[model samples]
Target: MTLSWSDPMFRSIVWQVVIIGGFAAIAWYLVSNTSTNLKARRIATGFEFLGRTAGIPIGEHMIDYEPSINTYGYALFVGVLNTLKVSVVGVVLATLLGTLIGILRLSRNWLISKLTASYVEVLRDIPLLLQLLFWYTVLQGLPAARQSFNPVPGVFLSNRGVKLPALNWEAPHLWALAAFVLGCVATHYVGKRADRIQDATGVRPRVWPVALGLLIAVPVAVWAALGAPWSIEWPVLRGFNFQGGLTVSPEYFALLLGLVIYTSAYVAEIVRSGILSVPHGQIEAGGALGLRQGVILRKIILPQALRVIIPPMTSQYLNLTKNSSLAVAIGYQDMVSIANTTLNQTGQAIEGIFMIGLLYLVISLSISLFMNWYNARVALVER
Candidate 1:
């Protein structure tokens, strides 16, 4: 028996097949045209160019890289790492700062509310690129190495960069790190158990104190047992510069500053909206039940607010990751920057573009997937 056109299921299946077939046909046409164009121009295409030596110098790299020794593929990998580093750090810092500002925006104090509002308006209104340029210029205009700003004995700042004392780690540090990881896992279980107990009984267990003991006290105890396998290596003034410390270059600083500041503005708005989306009656209800302000916020407001907050927050995170491509403007060696160099050097525009797009697609999808999962967990379950 044939399915009737009037049937909703039959119509739905027909529409889906038509859409899929159309997409497939378009994809085939595009791919065929790209191949034909490459062939016509006698241009070589493949991933073999990745193995060739990249003779260009890069300012900053997390991994061991030398222009004379490493391949183009390695350079691309370094770029990916740099992008991830900035994106991760920017996301964390932005979220924290933005959340604070958002909370302050709703403050009972007039000064705080006005100040936060002004900050949000200023940051979001200014173009991110211009802000980056301004920061870079300001950093570059700082005093020279000889007249460097010394905020603390071991910390120095100048036109060159900011240098802080570096931690020298020993083998035992690994064991300390392992202990810290174990403590974190224990804390997570403890928190879950606390929540379960709270649900079963009317009394909520105080998990923060226990969590702090596990996460912080246990780590400290492990570190002491391991003979504190670390030393601070302070920056010392060499002939014209500071040496032997952790350095933050101006380019990286500018990029990070701009990303955090700009993204935080948007995040503040998202957070404010999320918090406001929660019904005021909920707060009054909590107060009626003899709950303290902090408890009400923690147990009620945040859980509900986070469900609204996470989806848009995910978009902001992805935007920050993608906007890291702006690192090229400030001479930061991010993925897009390195890929641009590769494309120019080898004249492999297609490959470079494809790689950059693929990397971004993977990153965006990963963030979306994670946020979606978290949102689902915290979301309201309706019967």
Candidate 2:
């Protein structure tokens, strides 16, 4: 049915069209102006510059990136990898530390609770940039190589960097890793079967112990069968410094430290609020049903609290990811820093900024999608 010109719905549609057209016109103006300005200044634009060689030096990179041999594309790829490395590790450590501090904040012990509270207040209140600079300073101010701080026999920290024992892998290590993967698949199947059994019999089977045994036993048996083809490559003190082990650069260490500490404070608050959002009557009900404290916490409390926790947790994760761009300040070769260098070298400012924003947008969207899927599974759905 067609609506009359005087109908309310027809008027509403006309207004919506007008608003959208206005927005489109504004967008067109901006783009046209930008193009004109670029042409006036004779500035190069477009993504083709990515293929050109990047003569800039990157101090720390996950992949092989020689300034003379690599293209801007390769350097950007290394930057992306470094960004992911720090973001992933920072998220995990922040969540664990945050959960611990959150739980401690609710502890009955006054001193423990106060200490955790103070930590949250101090860290979260301070600017994250300041914290990053402070941590970088601390790491860079350590003793020189000859007088390096040796926390343990093979582990050393100094102005040079942090060195720890590295893994020396061989053929048997592959076999052992394959066995471990198989064990994980088996364990998942076993857990599903156990859940089915519980639904039918009202008795929960001891699945975790069995799964743990399979994980350990299968890996060990495979390693033994293949003669345990792996060894620890320990760092050794050579002429002026230690060598032969894995070294974490000061920039990375500082970036990780700052992000984890700062983000964890906010995560702690989110966790605490999530736990408290559960009704007190539920805890009393669990106790009355003869469930132990651990069982109540694990089976009842965590499941409900997770629904509230995950959505906000996703936000913190995205924040941590974007904040990783701050690595440029301390000379860490993250994607943003590389993009900036690329911009300077090629004089392609617009293309460089677009690529940096696009990379971050992709990362944020990926995390958001995964968290949304998980949240759907765990959310409280009314029947």
What is the alpha-carbon lDDT for the whole of candidate 1? 0.92
Query: Which 10 consecutive positions of candidate 1 have the poorest summed lDDT?
Result: 169-178
Candidate 1 residue-wise lDDT, 301-335, digit = tens: 99989988999999999999999999999888999
List candidate 2 segments past 4 Å from native.
1-8, 237-241
Clashing pairs in 2: none
Candidate 2 differs from the real structure by a C-alpha RMSD in angstroms, to one decimal, of: 1.7
As a TM-score, model 1 comes out at: 0.92
State the lDDT of candidate 2 residue by residue for 5-26, as single tens digits.
Answer: 8899999999999999999999
Tell me the TM-score of model 2.
0.95
lDDT of 2 at 198: 94
Error of 1 at 57 (Å): 1.5
